[model samples]
Each structure stands twice: as C-alpha cells, then as structure tokens.
Target: MRASRPVELVCPAGSLPALRAAVDEGADAVYLGFRDATNARNFPGLNFDRDEAAEGIAYARERGSRVFVALNTFPQPGGWRRWTETLALAADLGVDAVIAADAGLLRHAARHHPDLILHLSVQGSATNRAALTLYHEQFGIRRAVLPRVLSLTQVERLIDNVPVELEVFGFGSLCVMVEGRCVLSSFITGRSPNSCGVCSPAEAVRWEETPAGRQVRLGGVLTDCYRPGEPAGYPTLCKGRFRVNDITYYAIEEPTSLNVLDILPALVRAGVAAVKVEGRQRSPAYVREVTRVLRAALDACQADPDGYRPDPEWTGALDRLSEGQTHTLGALHRPWQ
Candidate 1:
C-alpha cells in the first residue's frame, strides 16, 4: 500500500527564519505571502517584504525546494490594482507558483504571466471536479488545494475525475467553515479573511482577568472563558464556548489541531499531488519541528504504508504546538461527520 509517487510536502513560511527552517527540515515546497493585505495571514510583524521574499526564494531554490507566493485574498472593486501588483511582484521574483483565490487576479496572472505556474488556493472553494475543471479550463490552473470539508472518499473521487493536480491539508488548525466563503468573522468584526486577510484580528481582541476565570473577547463579544489551570483557546467566534439549551459548550467547533497522520497512505494512493501544512503565523521553532516530524512521517508512510503507524514522539511534539493541546482527524473520517 505504499505511495505510488512521492507526494510533495508543502510547508508554510511566515517569516524569513521560518522559510529557512522549512527548507532545512526537508520541506519540498514552502508557501508565503507579502507583508500586505494581499495574503490571507496578514498579521502584524509576520510575512516577508519584497527584499526578504527574494532572499527566501534564493535560499529555498538552493536547497532544491520550491517557493510559492500566496495572493489568496480577494480584492474589492476599487482595490483590484493592489492585487494585480502583488501578482506581478510574485511572478517577477521567480516563485514556483502563485496560490490565488480571486477570479480577477487569477485571470490577470494567466494573461500577464502565462508561463508562471497557477495554483488555485483552497480559498477558491473548488470541492468537485466540475469546479476544478472550470478553473483549469478558464484560467489554466495547474493545481488546486482542496478545502478541508471533503472526506477521504470524496477526495479520491475528485482526484480520479479532475485533470488538475490536487493538494490536501495534511496537518494544521481546523477551520470549520470552508475557506474564502466564511462570513462569520466579517459579521462580527469589520474585517474578513478573504478581503482583509485576518480573522479575529488582534487589534479587536480583549483579555480580562477575573476571580471567576480568564475571559476572552473579540470585538466586544465574549468568545471564550477559561478557569484556573485550563488551557485557554484563541478568541475566535467559531471556537467559542456558548450556551445552547442551558449547556455551555463549543457548539460549532472546538479548539483542536488537524492531524491526518493515520490517513497519509490513503491520501498518497488517492493520487494527491501534494500535502499542505497550514500555519504561516506560527513561530520559526514551530515550523521547524512540525516540518521535521511531517517529513519523517511522510517518508515513513511512503516506505511502508501498510506497516505505518504514527510515532508517539512525533504526535507528542506536534501536540505541544497544537491549539488546546489536542488533535483530531477533522472531516477526513466519515464517522466523525
């Protein structure tokens, strides 16, 4: 049951050091964004400027690793110029591919940089073969990162039917809603991940200490509260513990990491072109350890898929870095659905 081909390992690069860490730890490719609202993870003090991005690209290329620029944010009517400029800069830097979501931006990239590789971001929301085909035919997208909402069987079916390359989320935080389409954040905060490149932006977050517990609020709304010695989660409206029929709990989703270690072999055999690790806002140390562990796991699974089991040490290492110190199979396993 070993993999038929070596699946590419796509890691994240939030900063220059993280980019080096990803390459040093054997990532096949690293995805990053410019320090602007063009990319999805537009947090302060993160991402690379133009010069830093060039350096990162050079470092990765030297190690036989590819670098992808993420211009995944959609542009408003008046802001189309910025998205176009970001695409041009990414193409000029000789990036291996551009992970884009907006239709206009993709069309602009296809027309201006026809030779550059175009990868439809998960934000593009092409969950089925028909949508994938439309993107492939219209904009010449070579690959598409599937949203995490699909099950293992669904992914296999889409891969069997679609002509473009497929990439799936192997490990990372879980977003209950599909990427690019979630409007909950925008409703609560004045910003949206698709347009503003942020979710529960730090500027709008508030933390309060009380005798009862620690209270977390996002844009003046109580998101989560944790008692003494409890692991407090990030303040996101989706992962919040709320009252439902007199019981307070995480009704929508909990704060857990997505680890597909047990299903790596199935994904590889399903003809997945790549496995993406989603965390560009994490620290360099986080990037280093996660890349190292996933690289080992992927290599091990390829070598002996039938005999493969997730190493406890690797799981522990990732768990320490996980949100709420927990992990799940996400939507990959049907029973969880």
Candidate 2:
C-alpha cells in the first residue's frame, strides 16, 4: 500500500559537517544536541555548542530541511536549570523543534516556549497509546519517537490509536537496554546514562591481551574477550561476552545494527509519520552514506509501493555501515514477538 503521507527521513547531525552531509543527501530533518549533559550523545567533541547550533540550523533550513535540538536527558534536582536553559537556547536559535523526555521539562517547554514544537523523545518511554495520548494532551507533543523494543503489530496498533505523529528507528546500532530505563551503564560507571551519554565511556574502557584472548573491560569489569583476528565491537556491558554458568558467550545480547529497508512498505502502510537514522556519535562519512541510501530507498518505496524491493547495492552499503558489519530487522519483525 502507498504511504498515507511521505514519511520524513530524519538523520543525525553530530557536527556541522554531519548536518551538511545529511541535508545534502536528502534528510527531511536532522536532529542534534548541545555539547553538554543537557542532551544525550554528550561525548567530548561530539555535539554542538551555541554558535555551532545556529550555524547548523541555518544550514539545514536553507536546504529545506528541519532542525531538531535534543534536550532528552532528565535533570537531577540541582542541575535542572541547565535543562531549562537548553530548551530556551533551542527556541532562541529558531530550532524547528525540540525533542524532550522528562515530564517536568516538557511542562516547562509547553509553559515557557509554547510556540515551539515539542516531540517526546524515545527516552520518554511511551510504549502505549495511553502514554502517547497523555504526553500529547498534557504537553501538546507533536510527535513521539518510539523505542526500538516494540514489534510491528504494536506499532501499527499504536498508530491507529494515538493522535500524535509517530517516528520509528529505521537504521543504526541496536541498543540492548530498555529505552529510558537504562541503569546497566550507571551501575558500573558511577554515572547515569541520563548524565553520561557514552554507553561505555572511553576513558573508563581498557583493552588488554590475556592468555585466553583479547579482553575488553569497562570500568574494570571484563566485558568481552575475543580470539586473534576476531573483530571487537565497541565496549558496552550489555553486548559483552561473559562467562555465565561455565560457558563464555554473549548471554545478554549480541552486537548488530538495525536495518528496515526490506520492510519499508509495511511501515508506510502502517501510517508511520517518519523513519529516523540514529547515529549522532558516528562520523560524517557514515551520516552521508546512510542518509544517501535511506533517501534513495524511501523514494523508491514511494515511487513503486506495490513493487518496492531493496536494491542489492543499497543493502551492501547499509551492511558495511551497520554494527559488527551486519544488520537485522531487529524487533520489528521478530518471530518471537
């Protein structure tokens, strides 16, 4: 079936160049954050500062693309002012919208920046119609990005039931933790994922050679070990291979990326308002290529809904960019679901 509307292709803009890359490659909108703890993806040298954000937003708007500033992290009691300031900055800079999760912050945005478009971040953890409805009714959120844990059927049902627009992840690295409820990173690192954006903060990671293999540890806890010639993934507690019950394996979740190109038609039919490419910590080249591929695929799907099939070259390109050099449908089409 043809999409009810042309789904917005939202991409990441970690830097100015990444923003330019996505806009040039046909992203309908590009989301970013400030270079502070007020937003996620707060790794050193990753996000934008004030001047940089203004420039990036101008660059995107001039090219007919929207800019969204992510103020998605929850604020601790004393530090809440920073979050409020970030929201104000986004509005002052003429940002197209701001993606926020915290109910208090959302209320603040609605009360103070009432004209600004509000999008409930995936961190808001609204997995049901009631939650989506509540956010929409209370704060007037224009859209909500769903967490990746939901199945296809659930997404379709939510779309049918909810009044707000829905955006789902169509590409990028998969997260093992429940969205908005991450504590695994906090327990080991002495930093909450809310405050520290890095899954395994680089400074705390140590890779060493062991008699068994190459061992990668996060904050001194051995997370994964690999034999010679084995490609090690980015160190994270959830994707780690650990010795559980005498068998060393990836007991929690294996490393992989999410690619939904094959199911584009289904998403369109389900009335998805947007499909996002999730990588703000990735490189400029990564953003350019992934955005290019998805733009082409979305266009092709729109052109030939009944006959849409992913091109082989497009599949290969996305696979090369995927985590661990492979991709899956993720939870969208999971048989177990």
Candidate 3:
C-alpha cells in the first residue's frame, strides 16, 4: 500500500441537528444537500432548506468543521436550472467545497465560480486513475470521491497515478450496484437514480404479513420474504433476495453495513485523502456516536501508526447502531462474495 498521512473524516449531515452533532463529535467536514432533487438523498422531510443550510454551515465553520454541499445528481432535461441555481447558492453560502457529478454542472461551476473547490462525487463513477485525472485536468476538481467498487490495492494504484485528492467510502451502507451505474430502481419505477436523485423512493416500499411470515416488496416486486424469526431489513432492491439459475440468492448484495473501524490503518496507508461515512437518513445520535468513535480511532492512528489499534468498544458501538442484520468490509478488501 502507498502510505500517506491520516485521512480527513468527511461525514454526512442530512439535518441541522445531525450537522451540529457531527461537528461536536469531531467530524473534520460535513457533506449535506438541500431538500430538493439537486441532491441524491432527496427524501421527504430530510435535507436542509436555504436558511437551515446557511445556519448549519455557520455552525460547522465556527467549530472548525468544513462544509461540503452535494449537488451530485444529474439534472433533468428541463430542470437543469434548479441544479445550476443550487450550485450558485452553495457558493454564495461559502461552503468549503461543492460535490458535483454532472459534467455540464461541473463546467458551469468551473466557469462561473473559478475559485469554488469542486469534489467529484462517486456518482460520477470515477473509478480509475485516468478518469479521475481527466476530471481534475478538465474541471479543476481538487478531489474525487471514488466509486465503492475498487479494492484497496486498486485504490492505492489510482491514488498513486491521479493528481487530485481521493475520498473513499470508509463506513456506510454498501450499494451493490456500481456507483453512478445503477438503474434497478429506475427500471421498476419511473424515477431515475441519476436524474431523479433517488434509488428506491421510500414511498414505493410495501410490507405485509404472508403465510410464510412477512413479505417485503419494492415497486410491487417481492424483495424478500422472511420467516417468522428472521430479522427484517429495509426493502431496497439491491439488498433484496432474488433468484438466478434456479437458486435463490442475493443477486446484488445481502443486507449489510460497511464497518471499517478495524481497517483504519490499512486505509490510511493506502493514500486515501478522506474517509466518508454514509448515513444521511440516520439520526443525529447515530452521527454523534459514529463520529466520536471514528474520530478517536483516526486520532490514535495519527499518534502512532505502528502502535495503533482501534478500540474494540467503539467498533462494537458502531455495529450496535448499524442497520440490517450484519456488517462487512464489502468491496474494499476484495470483491463482494
């Protein structure tokens, strides 16, 4: 692995309280979105409004935490105006950076706000060094949020070759599909993940009691039918059980969280610039707990790379707070098995 300094902890803040909690618990930076289609996490009753966003930015800045606004989703044909306007507003708010995926919007930001720092979102699927370098060369993107599909070795290679900074998903819910390449949600519903800013819209989920036990469905497709004693997980299409070759299996990914607390040192040595925590829909309490634990772990690693070992208690704490029935390193170590 290509070793580097300790990586920055860039966490998610879906709401004002979560923003405050993240900063207080020791997040170096917080990434959030406006409550609109311009952001990928465009769920109802989530995300910040203009006033709330400004307040959250100020709150984070006062506590020495940087704020990055996500303008990651591709714009709809006639709805390009909304994304453009949101970018302008984010720049006006003095956010430390803006996470963007669309090429056109990146061009607009590069032209209009030359000094505004741009971080390429993983939604752009910049997996390789060539693609990452191209974005940096063309749009002056300072950092790239790499797709989750790359292994640690691959990330080390990309980091070695790419000129821009690299951010990887350190801990989060693993999306089975390649980042920026998933169309499963859109195939079932009219909404497109890239353009509509949602994968499986919450409104499309359905659950009911069945003769076997409980059946969970998404967009009228049976996702998983659980026995009476089995733990029920959220019905996202990727994590749902499906059949292939006459054998029922999890076609995409099993319902699992990505908890990489133990692998902090390995990731730090892999030339990663930032470590992202992916839970915009989680509670502020979850933000606080996870941030506090990871912050300490990173601090320990920075203090003594050779002597560092993540606290077993903190790892347990994160696992307890995680959703689904299990957690794993996902594709970071190897291909999802």
Candidate 4:
C-alpha cells in the first residue's frame, strides 16, 4: 500500500491553557506529562495533576483533538509502582495513547492495558530500523518517535524498513546527545534524566558576577561566562563553551532552536507519519502560534502534493516565537560540531 498522506501535527501541552491553545489554533493531537517524575520535562511549575490531566484530555477530545500521555521516563529502582500506576490511570482517563521509553513500563502498559496505543518515546533512542522493529515486536508499539540524529535521507530509508508509524520532530530545542543515551546530567548533578524526568534541573542552575563579567553555572560548576551585552544561553552542559587545542568554543552545540519550517515538504515526502512540535515548557501563546501555522502548512501540503511550498511568512512568525537567536536543522543533517 502507498504510504499514508503526509502526517498529522502533534503539539505539546504542558498545562490546560496550553492544551486549549493548541486545539484552538489547530492541532490534531497534543502530548503532555503528569506533574511527577513519570515524564521527562518534570520541572517545577510544569505539567498537570491527575484531575487537570483528565480535564485536559476531555477538553481536547471534545474539540476533535487527541491527547497522548507521556509516561516516558525509566522507573527508579524500588519505585516502579508509581510508573505502573500512572499508566493505569492514563488508560482509565481515556488518553488516546501513552508515550513510553522504558522497557519495564512498556511491558506493564502492555499487560494491564493492552488496548491502549503505545508510541515509543525519543528517549528510547531507536535510531535504526532494526532497533525500532525490535520494539514493535517486543512491545507492540504502534508508533516510534524518530531520534534527532537521522537526516531526511536516512529517515526515508528507515521508514522503508519499518512496519510502524514514524513521528519526527519538526520544531524544538536540539539535543546534542542522543536522547536517553545521555548520562552527562547524572554525572554532574547526581540526578538521572532517564529516571527523574529532568535534564539540567532548574534548581541546580545558578548565576553569579565575576571580576571579568558574569558566570552561568550548573550545580555550582561554571558552564558559561558572558560579558556585557553578550547573549547568555541557558547553561545546559552539552551546549557549554569549552577549550580544546588552546582555543575555546562550544564543544557540543551552541544554544539554538531547531526550525524546520523550510524542510516540511521534504519531511512529508520522507514518509513521516506525524510532525511533532516539542515545547512542553513553552507558553500558551507559543503553542497557539505554532499549531496554527503548522496546521495551515499541513493542509496545504495535503491539498496540493506537487505544488506545496511552506509559507515563508509562517516561518518568520515561528522564528519570532522561538527560544534563542540561533537555530539549526541540528543532527538531522549531521553530528553538531
């Protein structure tokens, strides 16, 4: 059978307002995490409580938008019950799907709630077709969120080999390290990103003034220093400036967002089943703007396959709502230098 027409837009919803904004602006689905360690973006003041999640799900479904609950973090030893219970609750609350990364959690969801759709999280790092297929065989995963490491060509190849739906990140922050493969945060902060659902926890970030300028630090170790009028990026360890061969430069990646508005047609042709906009930490206005623009783009692509070009004006609107001044296609093309 020919591949399904382009893909739907999967937006993020960190709060009830964000969910409403996404649906109002036009999203086919929204993915969110619980206000606990079960989801990866578990920062303070983010995520929804159980009652709020149910309400959010109802709100989306009433508007013809689906909700996917992300129970994507690995369960801590001796704390698997929490993860298991969260999946059960999500099923009970009638989420359209549960995005999972951990094998144990996947097994639990499969056993207890076999009817629920399971989408593999990017944290699973299922980069190749073989790995993705293995998950399909073992856990009955309906979809796999392709990692940020594959190029458009590689994505096409992978899709040809796999027998499941594929979701690709269309817009968001770029992670230099492979998702779930990263241990840098744990090494520094003694907190596991895979288990705790947070990388570079906000409480661990600090800033101070130095004689030369100002210093941005993570867990008391200086990660970046900024002089007057210089732009200071978030002090994520992977994006920190470092010295090598007697010269200092950003060792992993510069602080930048990923804007693939210009490449949406290519991604569609590559057999992407869904285009995901990643920003659960973002504001409702951001969700509204992006969902609206991407919805229009997707509709245009579907309406005229051969004559579709994303609107440059929509891209500019997205750029205005982006996080940082720097933006890149990121590892989708090649490893960041």
Candidate 2 per-residue C-alpha lDDT over 1-337 given as tens digits, one digit per residue, 9 for 90 to 100: 1135689999999999999999999999999999888877888889998999999988888889999999988898887888898889899998988999999999999999999999999888888989899999999998999988889888888888898999999999887555888878878987665765556787889999989999998889989889999999998787888887899888877788889999998898888999999999999999999999999999999888899999999999999887788887778877623
- TM-score each candidate: 0.97, 0.97, 0.96, 0.96
Off by over 4 Å in 4: 1-6, 335-337
Best model per lDDT:
1
User: Which residue pairs does candidate 2 place in steric collision?
Assistant: none
The per-residue C-alpha lDDT of model 2 at residue 55 equals 92
Report the candidate with higher TM-score, 1 versus 4.
Answer: 1
Q: On residues 1-337, what C-alpha lDDT tens digit does candidate 3 reach at each position?
A: 1325458999989999999999999999999999888988888888998999999988998999999999999996798888899999999999999999999999999999998999999999988877887898899998998887877777777877888889888777887667889888888876766878888888888989979779987889888899988888877788888899998988877788887777777778777889999988888998898899889988898778788987778878887876673678878778564
Give the lDDT of residue 321 in candidate 2. 85
Model 3's TM-score against the true structure: 0.96
What's model 2's lDDT at 135? 97
Task: For each of the candidates, give the backbone clash count.
Answer: 0, 0, 0, 0
Q: How high is the CA lDDT of each candidate model?
A: 0.91, 0.89, 0.86, 0.85
Clashing pairs for predicted structure model 4, backbone only: none
Name the 10 consecutive residues with the lowest summed lDDT in model 4. 1-10
Stretches of candidate 2 above 4 Å error? 1-4
Question: Residue 5 of model 1: what lDDT?
Answer: 53
RMSD of candidates 1 onward, in order: 1.7, 1.7, 1.7, 1.6
**Model 1 stretches with alpha carbons more than 4 Å out:** 1-5
Q: Model 4 misses residue 38 by how many Å?
A: 0.4
Q: Arrange candidates by TM-score, descending.
A: 1, 2, 3, 4
Better of 3 and 4 by TM-score: 3
